[model samples]
Target: MAATGQVFLLLGSNLGDRGQVLTSAREAIAEQAGSIGNQSAIYETEPWGITDQPVFLNQVLEITTSLLPEDLLRIILNIEHDLGRVRYERWGARVIDIDILYFGQTIMDSARLTLPHPRIQDRRFVLAPLTEIAPDFIHPLLQKTSSKLLQECPDTSAVSKIP
Candidate 1:
């Protein structure tokens, strides 16, 4: 039997009610897949990539599920759509953004997905909350824990813990 896996997902919003968007996304994930192990406190930060857009609120979640990586990706996309996300440009402002940061220890490089997210190490928004939940979780590619990666990530973007 295929073993269920622990997956880490990153959620962010720069438009609408950011807090509600994050909550809704979390709930949506649960509805689609199952329970999330833990959800880190929300954090507000300046937008990356496209600096011209509004700042974003970000959070990371750890979920354990039986869904395969590709299926999980589709589910995440559906949740984003349900939450009013419209993808018109890269790094654009969004109502809700959901990204699969990691799926267990799987490292995949395909046309659709890449495990241990290629840019995760460079994004403070992703690393901060991730470290909060799984400090010792190792990056399959970098071979470093989330806490270590957070320490080394050059991104100094301001972030705060929210209830």
Candidate 2:
């Protein structure tokens, strides 16, 4: 497969059975999004955006898919809904939060989606795991590698890998 269709995704859950939630989400993703390639070790992270919520178990994944970026977004939203994700507030605790971190080399800036996720440069929770699998992957917009982004990240929230 060409590199253009390769995509990176982040999954976070702070509600119930986080590990199981992630596992099932991965299964649904393979069915709707594409094949799951490299996946990072799950990380336990403090809340971001809204710090008054439960801490999250986060995981990052690399996928090779035929679905267009928007289509993939639709599928992820569906998965989140199926997993009982409720967006009562921004960055609030969720059953499952699936974010499209990167979509190959595509740089999109639309109302619905944005490629090379705008906040990745500062989120250690996202960068930590992403660097595990795609350390050298470049941010299409920032022109920086994942490792560099993680090193330079300013978000000080605690992050630790889980077995």
**Candidate whose lDDT is highest:** 2
Error of 2 at 148 (Å): 0.5
lDDT of 1 by residue, 1-163 (tens): 2645568999999999888888888889888976888888888888898899888999988888888888889888888888888999999989999899998989898899988689999999899899998999889888999999999999988777776
Residue pairs whose backbone atoms clash in candidate 2: none
Model 2 agreement with the true structure over 52-124: per-residue lDDT tens digits: 9888999999998988888889999999999999889888888999999999988999899988788999899
| Candidate 2 TM-score to native | 0.96
Task: List per-prediction Cα lDDT, in the order shown.
Answer: 0.88, 0.91
Error (Å) of candidate 2 at residue 104 is 0.1
User: Relative to the unseen true structure, what is the C-alpha lDDT of residue 109 in candidate 2, on a scale of 0 to 100?
Assistant: 90
Residue ranges of candidate 1 with Cα displaced over 4 Å: 1-3
Query: Candidate 2 at 73: error in angstroms?
Result: 0.5
